[model samples]
Target: MKQDVQPLIVNVKRYTLVRNLVFGWLTVVLFAGFLLNFPKINILEHTARNLYFHVPMWFTMMAAAFVSGYHSLKVLQTGDPLRDIRALQAARIGTFFGILGLSTGIVWSRFTWYVGTDVWWNFDPRQIMVSIQLLIYGGYFVLRSAFDEPNRRAKISAVFNLFAMTALPFLLYVIPRQMESLHPGAEGNPAFSQITHPVMRLVFYPAIIGFIGLFWVLYTQRVRVAWLKYRVTQDSEM
Candidate 1:
């Protein structure tokens, strides 16, 4: 029973934009106007509004991390060097999305938590710790570049990435629940139920799909660029 439904879901997700383009665009246009017409729908009104950007950022990061882990596992099994490159590329994508997530979150937090303050950042527990998560990836990239040997770089990086899952338990699971956050919601707690009107739900869901698709397209392009650069470097070395 499970096997029968799995492929169906996979196929639909794979062709989301293709199957729903007309509806997707209509939703896009509607959400665009809805957000504009009702400025109060934004994070300015409440942290619920941050869902448009913040949730997508986290989604993108998870997508990137999934790619990274898949490639890492392949490299582990097949000893393929290209898989390592792919994993690195995916990790880089995650890093980019992670930084954006932090920045957008700070913007949302500033008005909600630290109103009238000259400086925007604060030591909010979740905020401080997410920054640490960001730094962990940053350190991964730095370590990747710092190593002179390719095999050594790939091995060390793959090992380092395994530890990232450790932070997830803390950052994603604990801090949001334990601390008194200025951010509206906690891990399991309901922040605001008021924002989930039918109009918002209709537009917001499609907007999320569109944004994620947009990020995937960019990721593919970046992978292509990295492959081309690798080819050039290989040709020159030969």
Candidate 2:
């Protein structure tokens, strides 16, 4: 059977509308994040604004990881090349967002909890686990490169993607909360809900929506490009 490209092609007009909406929505989120008056916590006063970007980025990465895994599962079920393309691109974009989240977190922690101390990485459990999670995803991409046959690469990569996705919850959330850490909701710690104002949720929720939207637009564009490249080159590795 011929592998049809119909499922891989995105609707141009729909893509444009969503792309524009994400752009506008995130623009508002950017301005509002900086401009809005947040209730002051003694230590976190101004840097609390990092909440809008940092937390939502992890949300986006989590969203992207699942999206990738879902497609990877489909790839396993049906052996669709398009699904493999999507899985790879989603993981790529998700990894980028994860890096941003991690970097922003380091900065956020330095100025707040580690202030006046030279500690950049204090082995916070969440931080360490999340870092390990990213490295696992990194191994997925490396695993993909090991095979030249498209079908073999797709199947193997799908398996690895599922593994990484499975690890995410434990590494990012469950294990972190079980350990002593600087993060909110750690063992014997106050969760964000207990520490911060309800007002922050107004921006927080929308920021999640906006960043996830941004991830979708970027993911769609990459899938389209990879589809085209596969058509021309008979390879979907991009």
Candidate 3:
């Protein structure tokens, strides 16, 4: 007789520690984002404070993207349903954060980069490329839904997930830098570091850490729920 191995959803004590720490850290980050004084820049003014929220979201999304990709790779190698669950949930949450980043970036740009103009959708390279990258992730989800069988679905979606993950860096960084864009580090624009003040960096760096921590907490919870659902249904769609 063959022995069945159980999946570890999460380590309860460690998960609790991480979840609480992320919540506390994010509370500080959000509070300090608005309360602390930021150096006002030309056309940015107080909106510069959005740096703590907006930029960190992209970092979180990027972290989630690579995480999703890594799990998807494992799914292909081991054919584990748990890895599939993680890959799907990570991409879903990552896409959610990516949308938030894009939306926040749009709001930030309107006030600073495109002041007094009615052009809200001017096809900025950074914006368009990010949108395309998100759509590719969208395709990954839809591809999962197309297959009724769990094993087949997991395998096929893992392949698609890998592709989506592989494309993320190019879409977010490489291609955007090559074109003229409203965002930093594009077409002769100054680098973010050179332009940023040290005082602002204090919060900026921590904000990235906090948001990435938040992503993990959320992803872990979702994985746990998916594990439960899989126990009941033997399917990992949720």
TM-score of each: 0.74, 0.96, 0.95
Cα RMSD of predicted structure 1? 7.5
- The alpha-carbon deviation from the true structure for residue 25 of candidate 2, after best TM-score superposition, in angstroms, is 0.5
* Pairs of residues clashing in candidate 3: none
Q: Per-residue lDDT of 81-103 in model 1, one digit per residue for the tens?
A: 66776777777778788788888
What lDDT does the true structure give each of the candidates?
0.65, 0.93, 0.90
Over 105-159, each residue of candidate 3 has an lDDT whose tens digit, in order, gives 8888877778889667779998999999999999998999999999999999999
Tens digits of lDDT, candidate 2, 115-211: 8999999999988998999999899999999999999999989999999999998899999999999889999999889987887778888999999
Top candidate by TM-score: 2
Work out how many backbone clashes candidate 2 has.
0
Higher TM-score: candidate 1 or 3? 3
Ranking of candidates on lDDT, top first: 2, 3, 1
